[model samples]
Target: MSEKTSTTRRTMLQGIGASLAVGGFSGLTTAAEAEWTTAKTGTDSSLYDVEYTNAGAYAVGAGGVVLERGPTQWTKIVDGGPTGNGNSLYGSDVTDDGDALWFVGSSGAIGEYAVRTGNLNDHSAPMDNTNNYNDVAVTGETGSANVYVAGDSGKIYYSFENGETGTWNYVTPGSGSAIQAIDFHGPRSGHAVDGNGKVFATDDGTTWNPVGLQDANVNFYGVDSDGDGEATVVGGGGMVFHLAESQWTADSTGDKSLLDVEVEDGDGYVVGGGGTVYSVDTTAAKFDELAGSWTAEATPVGQNLKAVVRGPNGAPDVTVGAGGTVLEK
Candidate 1:
């Protein structure tokens, strides 16, 4: 998802008081079970997003820097990535099989990296549009994943044939509001969020419908479209909005804007602000025994966090943020 919020929106978030915690999720343990560990990335460039796959943990950021987390440490695998012209990468996702990683960013820069190999496939600027891409989601195995890209111009550009040049198409979910994030749970089913407080879902990847977040005043920067009626949307003022079918619930974890989130299998992670990290338990909160499902964990840095993703295997969730700060929770 996109990293920086607009100046006008920032003011609105600061002025409007956040509401009480909303009802969602089941209770689960965090913080006590594990702590966040800052990994040394060996660079100071801001890291905007991270994705965990079977191949490894990869991060993309400023100047198109791509990082890989190994057994020993984090290393810069690519400099001036895909475009090789210093276009910052803002969003990324892995294929269903977790074999390839695709990233989208400034100047319509889009590229796919074979996780097992070092090969980078350039798929930038489909249809000759140079708009910035905020986020992306793929819904199939490597080499065949349907690529859905969320553009900052409030459009969704997609390709069914793995982003092949002529196979791409575009659709605007809202009235030209910048689409900050897009996530898919099936081959053609998923959700997206825009800068204008709009939430949209699509069953066929072309026709989008307003699913939730009705009359919202805050902008949503991230979305985890788990299923038809289940999603976690995070945005300004650390707000979290959850959709349980047609009902929508709202709450705030803190005052800092939540830039990104990922929830799956009843567990997830959220990150934002300077060193802000949240462990989300999507299981126990449904029982009403747990009042709030979010738990804040301490971090080792002060850089503004950008994006987060689930960990591979039994690894802790990985979050990337400003100044290239990476943390394992």
Candidate 2:
């Protein structure tokens, strides 16, 4: 197991004997009515990422702006993030228990925000290197989760003790090529993609081994791991790669570069450039091709969608991106 198992936000609906719900894209004669509403977070700063956990929905981006979606609308929770320097926040993830949200970005700025209380903790610039950090993932209970930060300097930073000072270390997952995305399915296992068309897996959170994609030449952007042997990698040119039975298969959904992907129990969502949205279903036992499993969903805005999470009983409960663009389906 590496970087997130089948127990995601919609893990309940993905349980055995339960019907996994998928979304309907309007203008397509396939599924639901494709109902999407543009949401306002009241900021023009680009929203780099979004997450939907049991705790709630969160969006973070440029200028250290963080927004939390309430029952009525989205509200700004942090003005300049934890750094107070206005550095851009690139990516974020909730703890395994969904009690805290951790975000990382420019100048190695990292912060942990308490979900229930508006409390924010500064945990930035570990190892004294202020290089930009790209994305983050946390595993374990809220306060004790293991922290993993992907760096633009081609290193992966880890802290086993809740990201406290002096507890962090770094590793270059593959050729020091700027790890683009990281996610964990179990407490110690997950996978990472790089800007050089490579994928790496780590079961112990410290030691990493190259997985595949050696012959490709596209920038690997986002990854969603169901296990070490079962995961999804989406990247340049709308490519979607799946790992199953220790073998990898590939397919392209469109021409846009996919920025982020998240899936649980065979249901998932992928977002990218041009506000491209894709609904995923990996329940079929296909041995070769990986096409037709993804359906295009309508985009309410043209801004490039940076990240996505499984929504309430469907795909893309929320997505945030360029210009603070948000969509709720």
Q: Where does candidate 1 clash, by residue pair?
A: 25-285, 25-286, 26-283, 26-284, 26-285, 27-284, 27-285
In the range 197-286, model 2's lDDT, one tens digit per residue, is 888898899999888888766788899877757778888888888887678888788899999887665566889999899987665544
C-alpha root-mean-square deviation, each candidate: 10.3, 4.8
Q: List the residue pairs that clash in candidate 2.
A: 2-189, 2-190, 3-183, 3-184, 3-185, 3-189, 3-190, 4-184, 4-185, 5-185
As a TM-score, model 1 comes out at: 0.87
Q: What TM-score goes with each of the models?
A: 0.87, 0.88
lDDT of each: 0.78, 0.78
Model 1 worst lDDT window (10 residues): 17-26
The residue-by-residue lDDT of candidate 1 on 12-130, one tens digit each, is: 22222121011110131122347777777899999988876655578999999999876556789888979898899999987766668899999999999997888999999999998
Query: How much lDDT does candidate 2 score?
Result: 0.78
Off by over 4 Å in 2: 1-34, 285-290, 312-316
Error of 1 at 200 (Å): 0.3
